[model samples]
Target: MEWIFLLLVGLAAGTLGSLVGLGGGIIVVPALIYLGSFIPGLDNLSPQVAVGTSLIVVIFTGLSSTLAYMKHKTVDYKSGLIFFIGSGPGSIIGAFINKSMNVQSFSLYFGLFMILVSIILMVRGKIKPLKLRSKYNYMRNYTNENGLETSYGFNPFVALPISFVVGLISGLFGVGGGSLMVPAMILLFMFPPHIAVATSMFMIFLSAVTSSVAHISLGNVHWLLTLVLVPGAWFGGAFGAKINTRLKGHTVITLLRVILIIIGLRLIYQGLT
Candidate 1:
């Protein structure tokens, strides 16, 4: 029964995460922590273990999503690589910080972060993309399925620092860091939504690798739990990416926002108790 629940959690996490470029860790971490309190074997779960296990699952989800998105030619590999330069190191730092947090504190902070991410999703569409004029910008054009080309660009100098912060949050919270990166890519970099999401998954894959290494070295991972979650997450990531190509996504986004808020409140209540 626990195994089945874990599998469902992984599937749900991966689908929602990949669909919105959030990297599924947001769902995995909290679910682990919640289940740990009641489930027999998981009763010993700590924040570190939960986070580490989630990051491992995130690696699979990100990779699966990236591959699926690559088939659509939406991933911006160059930008993803540049973002990794900063995120890789930042992930290490964040992993180290995660070691110091206790359950109550981690729950509180993660809950707050989830609420913030939900708010970001709510307003993301309303904000117009910013136009920045700079010689350092890396410009590119994306041709959609309908044969319309859209141009976008971003300055690496600006993007690197932001990605670093995103990585830090990712490692600390066991999230894929797409919640922050997607918005930044769309607003600051003028990336098309599909391109930003695809590129964000690529970066998430890289950052998760670094973060997972750090967690492993720290002895924070729950290997058994991670193994059980991977297959579901992997398939769900691919499924979500395929859906992204055909679905309007707005309805899903709305449902996701409500779920996040509910989860955030529940986590906050748990923390307070």
Candidate 2:
């Protein structure tokens, strides 16, 4: 029953995470922590251990989703690369720092962070898109695999700091940087929704790999539990990406806002109690 519960949690987290460019951690970490209370053996699991295990799960889930988006040529490698550079090192730094934090305090901070993220996401969702015709005179241009036109322009320099911060949080919480990166890309950088989601998965993969290695060295992960979640993560990731391809950019943002609100409230409750 525990295995089954974990697997389903992985699947749901994987699917939604991939779709929203949030890796499984936002959902998975909370699931592991809350679900642990009901699952016989997991009840005693530590929050750090839960976070570490979620990172491993995100590694697989992000990969699966990235590959799916890559197939559609939705990924913007150039832009993703810029942020990737900042996030990788930040992730490593965050991992080592995670070693010294008090668990309960960390949980409280993490929950507060989630609430903040949720509020920001909702506000961003409500904001009107800027008319960039005058500003972005030199339009970036491209076509997708089927030769459908797709293009957008953003300053990479402006994005670096945001990416580094995203990575720092990701490494610290085991949540994929996507939770922040996706919203930032859309709101701050003006990335098209599809492009932002695709690029986010790629970046998450890079950050998670480096962070996962750090967690392993610290002995923070639970391998057997991660194993149980792997299959579900992979399948969910693939399925989510497929769905993402079918949805409109606005629709995706709406879904993301809703999920963040739910996750943020739950985390806040957990922390408070």
Candidate 2 structure quality by residue, lDDT tens digits, 1-273: 778988998898888888878887887887787777887777777767877898999999989999999898888887877888889888888888777766466667777777776666567556544544445333456676577775566655556778888888888888887867887777665677778888999899889998989889888899998999989999999888999899644575567567667776766665677
Score candidate 2 by lDDT. 0.80
Which portions of model 1 miss their true places by more than 4 Å?
A: none
User: Against the true structure, candidate 1 has what lDDT?
Assistant: 0.93
TM-scores for all candidates: the values are 0.98, 0.87
Per-residue error (Å), model 1, residue 44: 2.1
What tens-digit string does per-residue lDDT give for candidate 1 at 1-273? 989999999998889889999999999998999899788877989999999999999999999999999999999999899999989999999999999999988988999999999999999888689999899999999899999999999999999999999999989999999999999999999999999999999999999999999999999999999988999999999999998888869898999899889999988887889
lDDT of all predictions: 0.93, 0.80
Flag regions of model 2 displaced more than 4 Å: 127-140, 144-150, 249-263
Q: Which candidate number has the best TM-score?
A: 1
